[model samples]
Target: MRLQDLFINEDLSIKDAIRKLDETAKKILLVTEDKKLKGIITDGDIRRWILKNGDLNQSVSLVMNTSPKFVYEKDVIHAKEILKDKMIEAMPVLNDKEEVMDIIFWNERFSTKFNQQTLENPVVIMAGGKGTRLEPYTKIIPKPLIPIGDTPIVERIINRFNEYGCNEYYMTVNYKKNMIRAYFDDMEKSYSVDYVEEDKPLGTAGSLYLLKDQLKETFFVSNCDILIEGNYSDMMKYHKENNNKITLISSLVHYTVPYGVIVIDEDGSVKEMKEKPEYDYLVNTGMYILEPECLKDVPEDTFFHITDLINKYIDEGEKIGVYPVSESAWLDMGQFKEMENMMEKLGVK
Candidate 1:
């Protein structure tokens, strides 16, 4: 990997810094000025910044870690020890003049990350909805079986989880359930996918009631149409450490208004005028890490959506948690345009 690819200007906007992080897919960026390492920023830094509702337009220097761990050129052999001791993915090598000479990546196999993570947690996928968004195509085939490249979107989602050693899967099935079952049954797989038959269209959380007796531990629940790229083990760690009843795996989505907007008072006077503004939100990625006990709250056999469950917890003064990922880390395929964009993003035909 090119060390230059991970370099970013210290004054770059947080919004653009996220873009650079996504472009490099390195989970980190080196903040440099005149080839001198000024600081370092990671996706974790950006997530924390967004949580505080910090302006995305703010410079990355505000969120970067100024005293980042590094190794000097003469101590190149110690780079491994520093990286290992700090548990960081990479370390910058500095010359006598404090110039960034190169970067030493802890994970030499850069094709993937967290090779040491092994998750025993089971995954539950909500795949029973009648996907009306895909239009005429859904009239014939199920959304879970809808192909992106040569593989279905659901398979891509599973493939991602599979990398972390999650082998057991439970899928809630209703519409075109047989097709979904047949496809996986006939194909070769390393993991086991069990079916949780939904007699009707059980809104997201309703079908989960069926798994109450089986899932005695913390498990993953995901919608059928989206994919997220991140460290699942780290997310699991956050979930357990926080003792959260439910953790929403949200993405920081940036929505830009196309036209100039005007803010008006009730008297019809323009209060404020601004150019096209971009809004950043922690959007629900239709995925969650849930404790099994939360399933008891789901109304039995009713069309209870996940939002209803989350709202119930909120109303009872229960604290829910959110794990935010970068905008590019989330790939959603709910609508036609989103499906096309996801395909394009994945470089799939």
Candidate 2:
């Protein structure tokens, strides 16, 4: 990766920093002034800031880790050790003048393997929906079979879970399921996938009842059309550490209004007017890590959405957490535009 790509001005807005992070996909950024590191901001920092409900319009300087770990170029011998010890993604090497000389990434210096941390959790993929967004494409093949680059979207989702050592997958399929099953059966894979057929159309989380008895441990539930690119192991660790019964994954998404928005009082008095105001929201990414016991909450043979279950937990005052990922980390293939965007994000033609 280019060092220049990781450098950002400290005065940049936090929302824009998010854009930069997603743009680079390096998972880290160095806030610099004249090549001297002012501070550093990684995905973790942004996630924490977002969790605390920090202001998005504020400058990066407000959210950056002012005291970031770094090493002098002359004393680069322990850079790798420092990176490993700190559990950070990259190490910045500074010269005697205290300017950025080079950057050493964990994968470049330390890892001789990939996804060393193994997780045995089963993954439940919701592939039943007819992707009406890509109308012409879905008319022939199912959404799961829709290609993002060369690989099908569902396969890509499975491949991501595979990295976390997930071997067993339960796919809930309905529309053109035979084609999906045939595609998987034709392809050679290391993991196993059992098809969970829904005789009738079940809303998002309704078909999950089929696996109530089968999945007895903590498992991941994902939509077939999305690929979330982040550390699944870390997310799982967060789930276990927080003692969360259900953890829904989310992304920090923002939208800016093109024109000035006005808010008027009931008496027709203007109360507020802001030009091009931006709004930041923690949007659910349609991926979740839920305990098996939660499956009991799913109504039998009834149309239900995952939100219904989450609401039930909320009504019961049960602990339900939402894990946040960067805007760049989540990729969706739901729409025609997003399909092209997903391909671009994955660097496919």
Candidate 3:
């Protein structure tokens, strides 16, 4: 990755920076002023700034870390040393003119070696759907088959799971099942793939019942369109440590109301009035970790949503918990507009 490619102008709005970080799956953004490195802005910096009453309209310079440590062209050796010493994944490389250059990333250059390996978990992908929103395109191909660079969106998802030693996959297919299977079959992939078929168009979480016999251990389920970047091991640890029956991967979504009127008292007297109130809520990221036994509750041959299932669990006093992640950690590429916006944020041509 190149620093210039990842750089965000100092004048860029905080909202734009946030969007960029969310789309690129990057934790930090290099801030530049007049083609010169000014500072580095990290997700943490913006978060702290927001905590301190920073506005979204403010420029990234307001929160960027000035005097950032960087690597020069001739200092490649020192750069590697700096990366190791700092235990950083990547470092911004610069030229003699102090111009931003490429980035040196450890994972990009080295194969990850692990000891005391964790158990391989299975991932269930909800890939069936007409994707009526993406029309015409979905008419020819399924949503999971949509390309995000050169690879299909679902491929990227599976690869992400594979990175954490989750090689087994259960894919639920309905719309264009043959095309999806054919595509994967032609690829000759190493990972094992199991298919779950839906006799009819089952709503989200409805097709999961088809895998009741196949699921023996705790497993993960995710929508094909949403991409979540985080440590899967950490999520699994949280699930098992808490012994939760269902764990939902949630994102802290911030929504600002354009206008706010007034609050009236019981006596018909105006109590309080505020303008443009901002609210925070935990929005489902379409990812979940589920225990095998939970599948027994999923009714057969009926349209059931995951939300409905959660409500049922709650009514039955079953343990259901949410694992919250930063908004930037969740990437949604479902709609065409969001996809275009993602491409811009990722700096893709």
Candidate 4:
């Protein structure tokens, strides 16, 4: 698509800009006013805006990059040089009047596919939860079998890792182990997966105890129903670079209070009164990277959550890192409502 195709008016709503970003498959858009370039906004910019609890109804100008990197139409060669130097995906080209003339893509300069190197670590999927929030659907088919498009949710989760060349998979199952096993057994896949059975319900990270000895290297643990939008390789790299015993993927979520909030003092006097307000918070996205040593601390059997493991490690002064991703990138399909929201955002009918 041309640069013009990705243009949004300066007054365009943040919500609409997001739609345009998804529709174009381009992570960015140029905000213009009467053919004049006002600024540029990328998916990352919108995510940061949301992280700051900005209103979705706000104008695109509120989050656009006013001083975005760009070069004149006469400086195309210089733009190419910049692209090469920065290793950026694309750079906008402007005419004498500062109007977007064209966009120079990385592929145009370097004729090679931008692929991320795959890591050969095992990905442990926690799929045993009885998706109580999904209700009647969970009653018929296992939560892992819940379809996100044509494929099951678990498959989508695994396929995402597959893109990064993560092959070995260790899935913990209990509620509907047979169905999950049969589903994978019938599939034709390039990767290998091993199912760890839990005789009883093992809370979140409990079933991982079964693979205690097998996983000696650093590995990943993810809930079957949640999907992350950031690069797994980058997160893994952060984990190793920081020497973290555990790395948790956190999603920035924006929550707005509908009603006016009042603060009262200890003596019951009204100290402050504020209208509806919004807040941004980092929510655990149920995705994590863990070192093998972390698994040893998990007791066999009994029930234990992954959070418990994190707390124990933190209390012992172990390093734990949090990699934040955009809210749009973290899809939680454990609940019917959240699944619907994710589907809508994905343009999945």
Candidate 5:
């Protein structure tokens, strides 16, 4: 990869650096000035900064790692040694004068890849709901049938799971079910898709009751409108390790409030006043890993939402987990604005 693409000035604010990271699709960046390496920054560094309530407007220099590990281009062998022993996923390569040359990924150097594990677990996609948020478009086609680029949204989601070797899909269809079925029928693909027709509007978890017998093992349930870019293997491992009956995949969402007013006191007096501030929250991405037992709780052919299932498990003291993923790791296409933004980011137009 081009070193210049991963190079950012130390003076760039944390917020702008984040955008740079997203644009480059690299989790790490070399902080440089005058064609030299000043430091290094990674996505983890920015997440930690946010957790510590650091100002997003602060210069990246404030949080960037000054003592970065790098090797001269000629010392590739030595770099491999450091990578193996140090467990570093990526390292920067420098010229004799300590000028940034390029970045090398450990996996690339060793011809290895991560998260390529094939998963045999069945994936249940909830495509039943009429995508009310999408409006007139949903009036013509189902939300899952809505195209992001050339492929439908649900197909994109299934493809991601297919990377993990999840070849069997159980799709719950209701609104515009015929259209969805017809689209997949015409496509020639390796993965096997099985449809579960919802006689009525079975809210989220309610439709999963149909799979109670088929899903005898741990499986995945996801909303057709959302996309998570993280590793499903890691999430499944976490769920199994924690003994969670249900695992909710959540992503960090950062928002800078467009305006800010005064904080009023109990007596209606202004307690404080400040400019617009940023906030971070863990938002559910409408994806889940579920143990087979959870399916039994859903009433057959009845309207029930996933949130209701979660509440029942909570009240019963069953193990439920929320796996936190990076903001860039999730793409929510449920809303029109978000869909447009995602299309733009993916270079759809």
Candidate 6:
């Protein structure tokens, strides 16, 4: 992609910057002042800003990284070296006057042959939940095997990862493990599927320790029943760029209450009453990017959820980040009601 294509005005609001970044599918945005390079705003920067302050109207300059590493028009060789040495997806190409120019993508030049190379990172899917909310259906067909369209919900999750070049998967199974295995075994899949049987139902992150010795790089872990429409490549870029041990893919969920909400003052006086107040919240979409070293903390052979792991890391001051996506991009198929809603929204019978 061209640098000019990725450039955003420094005066643009945080919300606009996010929208543009999502639309462009580029992790870094060139911040320009009167068509001149001012700084670079990355998805990580935006996320960190949001975490620090929930202000969306702030200017991009507040979160942008000034003095970003860049390459001049005549420094193509040096640019490639910097990109490779830094292990970055793309580098901004600038002019002598520090004006926005273009971008040089690493994948477009090198790693072309390996373009078809299945991403080696193992994706650990937490599919052991009993899914009591979906009761009768969960009792028969495992939650992972519940159909969304023509394929099971878990298959869709796997396919979404595969689209971003991930192929190896480790499914943690306990409830109806055989059924889940049988379903996948019967189907012709494009990627490899390996199951880690939990003798007892291990909550989310508990079973991840089973693959501790196997993973040497950052890997993705997700719940089998939620579908999030965001660029995995961008998410990975944000993960590496921020040097985070764990990066959670979050969605901005909005809820509107139909009834009026009353606000009282300190003296019990009515301050105000707002009818049908709408609220926005950031929720974990059950998708994550985790570094290999972090897996060492997963206690062996126990029941623990990923949330517990996150809390542990946060308590220790380890960096954990969240990348926010719009609600329309996330589809939860974990419950009967959500499944019905998703089917209706997706127009899938």
For model 2, the stretches where C-alpha displacement exceeds 4 angstroms are 9-11, 108-111, 114-116
* Candidate 3: segments with Cα more than 4 A from true spot: 1-119, 267-269
- For residues 114-173, write the lDDT of model 6, one tens digit per residue: 222245577888898888889888878888988887878898888888877888999989
Full-model lDDT, candidate 2? 0.89
Query: Worst 10-residue stretch by lDDT in candidate 1?
Result: 108-117
Q: State candidate 5's TM-score.
A: 0.81
My TM-score estimates for the predictions, one after another, are 0.93, 0.93, 0.71, 0.81, 0.81, 0.71
Kindly indicate the candidate among 3 and 4 with the higher TM-score: 4
lDDT of 4 by residue, 91-150 (tens): 888899887788877766667655555789999999888898998999989999999878
Question: Which lDDT values do the candidates have, in the order given?
Answer: 0.90, 0.89, 0.81, 0.84, 0.86, 0.82
RMSD of candidates 1 onward, in order: 2.0, 2.0, 6.4, 4.6, 3.9, 6.0
Ranking by lDDT: 1, 2, 5, 4, 6, 3
Residue 66 local lDDT, model 4:
92
TM-score of candidate 4 versus the correct structure, residues matched by position: 0.81
Better structure of 1 and 3 per lDDT: 1
lDDT of 5 by residue, 1-349 (tens): 5778888888999888887877777788899888799999987687667656688789999999999888898896797778766766789988998898788787677765542446899999999899999999999999998999998889999999988899999999999999999999999999999999999998988889988888999999999998888768868887898899999988777787888857899999999986797776878889999999888899977889999999999999998887766777788888899999778766785
**Between candidates 5 and 6, the TM-score winner:** 5
Writing each residue's lDDT as its tens digit, candidate 3 over 14-69 gives: 87887787666667788876667888877667656654656777888788988877
Error of 2 at 268 (Å): 2.0
lDDT by residue (tens digit), candidate 2, 119-223: 999999999998999999999999999887788889889998998899999999999999999999998999999999999889989999999989999999999
Worst 10 residues of 6 by lDDT: 111-120
Candidate 6 wrong stretches, greater than 4 Å: 1-54, 57-118
Summarize candidate 1's per-residue lDDT along 260-281 as a digit string, tens digits. 9999999999999889977878
Off by over 4 Å in 4: 1-85, 96-99, 105-112
The true-versus-predicted C-alpha distance at residue 15 of model 2, in Å, is 2.2
